[model samples]
Target: MTDPWNPADPGVLRLPSGRLVRGRGLRRPLDGSAPTPSYALYLLGRQPPPVTWEFRWIRWPDFRLPADRAEARAALTEAWERAAGERVEIACGGGRGRTGTALACLAVLDGVPAEEAVDFVRSHYDRRAVETPWQKRYVRRF
Candidate 1:
């Protein structure tokens, strides 16, 4: 298992179309001992400054899609569009669960069979990803 406190180095998940997206978890300092991380972070771009990719936040703890589905869709669409130009990142508190769910959705968008996405995330990213039973169900819905 990953340390959870320390996220893995980001990577590109190449879609069948040759586009790419990065995935990870943005978490509050685990040292604080808070119940959960503040929010999920999904960013689109390469390293360093002047990155062209966009960024979005999904509130954690609750784990609902953004209040504005359109915004969420727009974010994903932009990520999809920019996937060829830059790396896109999807993250949650533990680099699992919410992050995994979002990554699975990206896999769906990438043309991976939706049913296989959860397992893909588990095998590739972190085994603990998509932690909750409902979270696994959510990935299927994507």
Candidate 2:
């Protein structure tokens, strides 16, 4: 699996429409050379620190589930739309669980079958992705 935070890597996923989106971990310092995202989705249990880039937060606890399903869907759909025309990123504390889950959802939005999205992200991004069963189920339901 590629290091999601690596500037050279970006851990990008190319959608069926040819749009690219990146997934990353907020816990690690971002690589200075990485391309700056025009928009970002930060999935965390609490509010994120202020940032200059346009961003949205989904109240998602680590190794757990999102606080609100409807909100998560709306935010993820927005992120997916933005990724079609701009650099977009989805991130979480460790970049594995929540980030992977979000990325899998994006994969589903990208035309991947929902049932396959989790495995798709795990193989393409990180082996340890989607750390919990519910996260996997969430991807399927996305």
Q: Model 1 scores what on Cα lDDT?
A: 0.55
As for candidate 1, its clashing pairs are 22-88, 22-89, 24-91, 25-92, 97-130
Per-residue CA lDDT of model 1 for 1-142, tens digit only, reads 1112222334335455655455555443323442221222452222222223345554445344445545665666655655545545665545666667777777788788978988877776667777777767766776
Write out the backbone clash pairs for model 2. none
Which candidate achieves the best TM-score against the true structure?
2
TM per prediction? 0.63, 0.91
How does candidate 1 fare on TM-score?
0.63
lDDT per residue (tens digit) for residues 31-108 in model 2: 786666788999999999888889999999999989999999999999888776777888999999999999999889
What is the lDDT of every predicted structure here? Answer: 0.55, 0.85
